[model samples]
Target: MKTFFQELKNRRVYRVAITYVIAGSATVQVVGTVLPIFHAPDWVQQVFVALVAFGFPVALVLAWCFDLEDGAIKMTCGDGRAVVTSRRVWILAGVGLLVAGSALTGYWLWHPWKRLSDAASMSSDTLSAPPVIEKSIAVLPFENLSDDKQNAYFADGVQDEILTDLAKVADLKVISRTSVMQYKTSAQRNLREIAKALGVAHILEGTVQRAGGRIRVSAQLIDARTDMHLWAERYDRDLADVFGIESELAQQIVSQLKSKLSAREKAAIEQKPTADLAAHDLYIRAKTLIASSALSTPQAESLLEAVHLLNQAVERDPAFARAYYQLAEAHDLLYLQGIDHTPARLAMADGAIQSLARLRPNSGEAHLAFAKHFYWCYHDYDRAREELTLAQKSLPNDPLPFQLAGYIDRRQGRWPESIKNLERAIELDPQNSAFLEQIARSYECLRRYVDAERALDRAIALVPKDAAMRARRAEIELHWHADARPLMSTIQAIIAKDSREGKNIAELWLYGLLCERDFDGALRALAALPIDGCHQETILFPRVWCGGIVARMRGDTASARAAFTSARNELAKLVREQPAYAEALCALGMADAALGHKEDAIREGRRAAELLPVAKDAIVGPLLVQNLALIYAWTGEKDLALEQLSIAAKLPGYLSYGQLRLHPYWDPLRGDPRFEKVVASLAPK
Candidate 1:
């Protein structure tokens, strides 16, 4: 036994295990993060936990059994005497097994408290939100210093360029543009909340200012964990040196993150874009046109011109992946909007984006283009999500993916969720006129009129001469009060303003206002908008809605019935196909109520409400409650009606706000004191 112990202690494996245990334990303690444990099964986690939990006990047992400090193995018999004592070697061998096992467990349990706490704080839904990311960042809105709002696009271009440059560092995680922009004007979120939402540890924030023939940029890298300002600086240069500014900013971030930059990464930072000043400006301006919420034909055409100049950019420098990516983006935008010949444009754009992607595998734009190509044209939601993830990594500050996420949610009737994503997109590009428009639209859809008004006010201020913003504001106000006068006057001003400038967005504005209530402005818009040659069976629904709204206004039930009959079957089919089609269900319910189909109204209203649980101020949420109340009233179930009305009265600016305004549908219970008491309770204090 003494000889066996001596040999075991002398073995090289004994020394190796001790070294590994010490080094591995220190690594586990110092470098541990959630990264190592993700996507691992519960049983694996338990095995790791068991290893860590048993480390100290095992070490003690090994020490007792080996007598390692004494350089011998002591074996005790049943009589409690040391029956056999071995030499140094065997004792050290047992110590080695104990230490190795202890280190493995320690590594598993590193930062256990923090890991568990972090996991506990997140909701699964938010964790699983679309455009998943490993790293996240927030791009605050660019500051506007230029006198002309038109120059706003230059700031956006600068920001986009920097995002593109940073994407070259493939190992670093990046948040997509859409999520960070939502915080531009947010009064609620802190840095931690922002980081958690974007799922990133670091953040890159910056500001841009435009001056005559020159630009100034200020940028910072933030350590999200500490909420510390890790680095910050300002750059003032001639407009021609914009590329320099972008590269410098990226290099600065890499330095701050202490990232190891490869030769390819270093080369990517210094690549030059177009030297033609006119072409760059044109491209920036073109991006502005497409950025607007309402798709404008003239803007699209202008963007095409910009794309032509961007071609000139690549002509000057064949190595410009950024230019190529933008060109691909422009073509896809045209194709999606039904402007450019889709097949040719899509094929060319896809090929260009793919080429650019190969050159810069970390490019957000490249991944974004491919994701969009599959998402819009191919309807491959899963592939789209994967591409969006990679795109987010490449360019973490652009809002397009967030905007896409929001748009998808809205179409699915997840209005609250959609609004959250859209708002983030606006934060990324606060000065962007397009972002403002989408936010306002989202607010309006969710029936948050105050929020819509605030967004619209900002947009109109940015583009005071533009008629669309003003029209949208007026339309929102009209719905809030259920009155059309304010909307009518705003459109006249819009038409007058457009006539002087030849910008025809006022007609588009009118088309939208007509759709809002269908009753208020459709006839005037129908008289003005283009409808001469196009023939699609889908056209009948808008026409029917227009008729319904008109009849509803005048209390002409029969006319409303006839008009609705033309669209009812189609609408019913639509609701069946997409259960989350809140708009269709809400409209159908309202039409049914007006036509005295109580059962149909109740059913559709209930379905819409369920589908839109998180949507605040939604007409459907309140409308469902209101209709349920009315149904109870008509059926002599006044108690039930009162209950539904009570539920409705809880909504912002709707329930108690309109309690006194009597509508005939609730007349059956008007004489009852119970109804009056319910109404009184609902009215705002």
Candidate 2:
């Protein structure tokens, strides 16, 4: 051992080892800092470190056998012995080089990252290529070939039925009906572009004709990538055999795509939704109305008509589980949108859910109905999620389950999860503006104003003239930079385009005017509203309340008191009818505070907070708390007001920098150090 140590020192092997270690360490440190900037894969750094390590032994072997003399290579003459150039020494040097080379080659061949990259490249042509989804399709709306134009709904029904059947197969990625309906009237029939937009590889187009108790259906499936026909069929069957033809067509598409169909999926596809054709027609009509309506007065009327049709359909065939599911959804929407937020509306939804459960308890539609019921009516998020899990397993291609999960996540204060689920829904329903709107709301709650605006921009692109989305996009400026001019300009543009559109966004226009401290404009906007009132989500504020707010802001004490008195009277009736209505109660509490009814104001505000706490609903619950803080400020309880305001500032809600800086609602808390601290906390960081 002593001779080996002396030999290593004489050959300067220790010097080479030390230099290599220092250089390798510096190289690793530099590479570690530099590689991430270029977005290199993690394994690149690992492989680099391994290569440097392999060179260390080879460096020491070369140092032992050779020397650099007068800047030239020479054999090492250890202990003055004649330049030890032996066969064993050369063999050892070669072995060291061979070992290092073998290590480098083995790592390149056997590393997990290498295998992963190779497999990925084999699976796809390019590194950045999207995975090729083989069994994916979109079913376009069937053309109405009937002599009677009203039979378009019948054609739509047949297409929807076939699409629904295809959706049941777990092996296929079927585009949702909402996405495919856009191509119903597409004259050019650009199959490739349509399929790309829908994220599918195959397209199915068909036509349905009904003539004198007989139906003729023609369907053709084409590979969108190649624009080549893969399958085509024409069926002339009696009206009674329409369901059979739809089932057969779905089976043929599955077979052509070579998708694995479990026995359960096959049985589900074969089962008929309804035995009565008349009832089925009514159900289809109801579904169409629900799909086409928005959240406006027209939407309320449309939903009501749908409910009537669904009721008639169920009456015709009590076992129509699909009709019952649609009925439940329509009723839930009516109640949720505040068109008829009465208990009777919720009870109607409950009745439909009960009937659906009795007929098909384990069906995806039934689970979805129950999930909506729990979410909208009870605010029971946990139960809704439990139902959603089951619905997702059965309805893998449907976007509703993921959309509802996003809603539940938002209510639970899981903003990241909410955004993720909403994005997943967009993947399944790329054209759904509702999903974009919801994701925008989630981003807004998290104070990601830029992301929120981008989401709203996408929604506005999908629906160009949507005043609501445009208004929302403009509102992000106020939250981000405490500027309201952009929102005011957008509202003016919308109102200028059409007075009806202005009426639709009347509440938003008033809000913008108030933010700008244009009391006269606010009052004028309020006066132009319908005599009943303007709605803010679930709350219907009376015009008197709006006038009272303007009067208070303008310091017209007598007018403010009188307006509040009348507004209080009207809101009292509303609170009496719907005692559990949190938004209406909050509005009434503000009215009471404006009128100096301090005790009543505080009581109503506390009741509203108790009805919807932040734990139960993170989105609206903080707004209720903020309203209570306002009540405290109005009642001369500055300490309590500051405390509640501080709490609201830290929670997720609609409180924005513009509102805190400019709105008169927080006037009483002005000049207080604690209130200023709370406002500064909410300012964009």
Candidate 3:
């Protein structure tokens, strides 16, 4: 035993053992700390630690057999007689231990059965069970296998038709097209991950190939949880029979899922949208464009192209109810967004709705169209509500009815109901930033700044380049704590990225600058604004009006008068062209007030308020009244201004703490106790 101990010391085995343990410990610590930076799985760190531990016995064996002498590694010297049995025994034991540890560690880390058991255990736990709805499914974008890639729209149309048919079945929870479209061109589709994200147990994937008036569609339904194919089929048919193929596929999926389908749902699914294939193709393209555009800030050129396509579609098939509905919606958005706020635009929307009503008087599409018409064109919340109720009953899975209901509820000051309806919309269309923005708007109106910011944060995450949403997110800080730094920083960042894109949010940038009393920055922003002006909801401010405000802020009376006069003339012409445009009248009233036309300003402001009263439109109505307050302030009507300001402050509107505290428009009544009290009421707790 003494000789064995001396041999171990002479070989420097103690040093090797201590060094190995220290190195192993350090390696484990380094791996544990570094792996998480890359978001490595928890099991990765555990496996790494096990690997380091498994090396312990191997290090001991090597240390026992070898010696580090001077600068060279050499085998330990032994007497010429025979190798010691005890040393041999100890080395063998170390080698055996190393092999055993390695084998066990590898098995523990990589065993398939163990992984399966763990997964099963997790699935069985009710507290941590995956949210997988048995009857829920997401239809991924069908691959376009046509030679002409431009026919991608045709493939999309096929997929959309199938999805629409499936959505009609009330028993199945079909993920909306907007949400599933993200996975359309994904190079790697993780079935389980996608299913979890979409909260569905089933996933449907397909391919569409079209050539020379013939089409082939292959669809497969998979149990995403188990990666098992439930059903699959391939259809080869003429282009004219595509609708039948979609209907048959929908029926098969419904049967496979064991979903109950009502008679009406079956009929609706089987009903062809258009008899003409060309018309169907056009309708599909138009609908695709509409889906890509945002509801709050729609692309005007895309909408115009969609209108042209839908018109051609309707002309090809006079009784295409869906095409007419799309047409009405396109025109309604055009009018609502002020892209083409003309009577002629409303007339076109009305014509489309009339045609739709004639074709499908009691259809969900008809009710939705009428609801949008009432809400967007007439601001008739009551009529829109009635239509929305009918639409909801017929379109159980549709998100539009709920989204519109939320909008109406917001306008009617039903904040909680609006939030509930918007949340419902989000559940059906999870990827829709527009719904998120609408919910954020309700939170903002209610002065729930944190909730509003959270909603906008989610919206911004969905669309990182959405300048309007980012601007709104920054504006929340201003509204909450009278802070303009965040708004200015966000705007500057956006502008620095692309100055041309700044025009999209020029109004917000100007607002931030004005809030900080940065007159020069406000002037620059106004100069960059579009000549036709910018819009905030229903109100349209001519660029000249913004210029006038900037000049007034700088105390340049001459420039202010000239800019206001120009704005007044332009707005007066617009009012003449659009006599009932309350937004235009409001701008004109402000311009008159700036030019010192006191009576004329007051009369125009009153008329504009009367045209769109709060009773009629709780959303835009308060904006007009707020503008009236500004008009009174400019005209030296202090008491009247304070009274109107008080009323506007109490209502749900764009009124913010930053605006009330910082904007110069209310300078006339700034020192008054009533005006100060109104501003105080808006301060964040």
Candidate 4:
């Protein structure tokens, strides 16, 4: 072993090995970075590294067989025929180099190809023998083939009906409508690509054509892996027979996909929602229009039009349960949109829901609508939970029920349960931005700010043009983290590109300025806002509140009093109209507190807390209680304030260390040890 080592040293093999390694590493590094820029295939870089590695052994063998002499490579002489051996060594070295180069080049080229072939075989094996999933399917939007493009709603209605029926089957994994409709207006991609994106094994594609009193639907089921049509059918039916067509299509698809259906599911599929074709048509049109309206920016005109259409639908067929449910949805949305957040509109929604319940005693749609009404209007969390449970039972496959359940859990401070329910909804409706945002809200309540930001980022990616999402992201950074500089550029860009989103951007700027205690900047932001009468209650309310705070900060008592009085009066009117409105009462309390009306502030704040007690309203409960605590702190009721703060800190709500540190309302509490402990409790883990 020692002689072998000495021979290696004598031949300078170590030097050759080190040199080869250094050169090989440099070559690999260079190729790895440069080849990618030229859009070279990954295999090209792999082959280069493999070739360099191959040269290492060849170089070492050459070092052992030859010696560097007089700046030239010469074969070693150990025998009598030194000249002959040197000549033969040169020839053999040349042959060895040629063979090794060829061999390495061949291996580099062939080895990856072989491994890739094996990988492909394995992939194919896994795909062919996929883990058992319950008959997963994605039903692409049916093509509208009518002369009048307005008939697109009719096509969507038919497709939705079929999907609705299929979703009732417990043994099937049906992707929700939101994800499936994304392919409707967009350019179609490969069927397999669509299927893979939806996490389904089968694809349902079809076209719909409607004439005066007749409807034509052509549907085919395909194996997503091979894009092979499993079944094809064409139905030419009377307009009134459309429900039957949907039922039959659903049955055929189930059979083709080999999914089992219980007796109840079969019964549900066979039942017709409405026998009157006119009522059905009107309901579908209203539903299509209502679906297009924005929930956050509800237009009164659009909602009124849908209401008119839905009213006509129910009048045409008084017993049409689906029409009644859609009518309720339109009414509820009209009120929810806050375009018509009046008692009359809320009463109308209640009336519609009652009618729906009377018409369809066990309808999932009725239960879901009632759940919304109970949650948003009545604020009856327990009743809302019961309704949601019934809805889930009736619509086991519907994402709406699960989503609503998640929201109920969120508002009730069940953070983990809320997350689980929202995640379930995401599994059903994978591309829903609203679901993603709600999930972020749940994360926020849990103080999982990082996870919340990630969720918001995902929601923003899905809806890049959504001003609400951008505002939400800004709020998290500015108000929750007290870090708004990073998001300032984005806010400015959004405002510059679309002045219409200026109001939302300005609100973000105001929050950012407030976080920094920049009173002048806050006043400037308030000035730049476009406050119109239509949005005075929403847009102007914040401006007034901020203006009051900034004026007080600058020692302008008269201006502060005027601002606070203006905000208080407006909020007082809202509270008078809706006595149970916790948010309006809280705002009034905040205004009173700002004006130094200690007694009034305490009264209004306590009233707000009573209306939104933590036992019944987890979402607004903690916020209102915290507002009361702020007032108490400012009025020097240290014990009362600390008690509220401790309770608020324990709840899964929006209280945070940043808010405690930055909010001017809580400035008086900063010196208190109890306040510091409460804020410290929320420290990031």
lDDT of 4 at 325: 78
**Reference-based lDDT, each prediction:** 0.59, 0.83, 0.83, 0.75
Each model's backbone clash number:
24, 0, 0, 0
Cα TM-score of candidate 3: 0.78
Q: For candidate 2, write residues 1-685 as lDDT tens digits.
A: 4665677787787788788778877887788678766758978877797888678767877888788879999866453754444654655466556756775666556554554444333223211213449899999999999999989888999999999999988899888888788778888899998888777899999999999899999999999999999999999999999999999999999999999988988988899999898999999999988987664534677898999999999999999999999999999988886667788998999999999999998999889999999999888899999999999888888889999998999889997788678777877777777777877877778776766776787778778888878888898888778789999999889888886776566767888888899987887677665454655444566778888888877779899889889989978887899999887798899888888899999999999999988998898788889889999999999999999998988887788777898777888999999988888888875
- For 1-685, candidate 3 gives per-residue lDDT tens digits of 6776676676566787678777876776677567656756767766776666667676766776666779998765354433556556476457647765775567556653444344333223311223567998889999999999988888898889888888878888888888788788799899998888777899999999999989999999999999999999999999889999999999999999999989998988898888998898899899988876563232677789999999999999999999999999999988887778888999999999999999989888999999999999988789999999998767887889888998898888787788778777877777777777887787777776766777787778778998878988998888788899998999999989988767678788888898898998787688677654667686877767788888988989999889889889988987899888888899889889988899999999999999988877778889999999999998999889988988999998888887888877777887888888998999975
What are the models' TM-scores?
0.45, 0.78, 0.78, 0.73
- Model 4, position 576, has a per-residue lDDT of 86
For model 1 the TM-score comes to: 0.45
- Output the lDDT of residue 49, model 3: 64
In model 3, what lDDT does residue 478 have? Answer: 84
The better-scoring model by TM-score among 1 and 3 is: 3
For residues 144-232, could you state the per-residue lDDT of candidate 1 as single tens digits?
A: 56778777667667776666566567655545443345565665547775675555667776677777888888887777778888888
- Candidate 3 backbone collisions, by pair: none
Largest lDDT belongs to which candidate?
2
Give me the runs in candidate 4 sitting further than 4 Å from their true place. 1-134, 275-282, 288-295, 298-305, 330-343, 503-506, 517-560, 633-643, 668-681
The C-alpha stretches of model 2 lying farther than 4 A from their native spots are 1-132, 527-544, 551-563, 577-580
Error of 3 at 101 (Å): 65
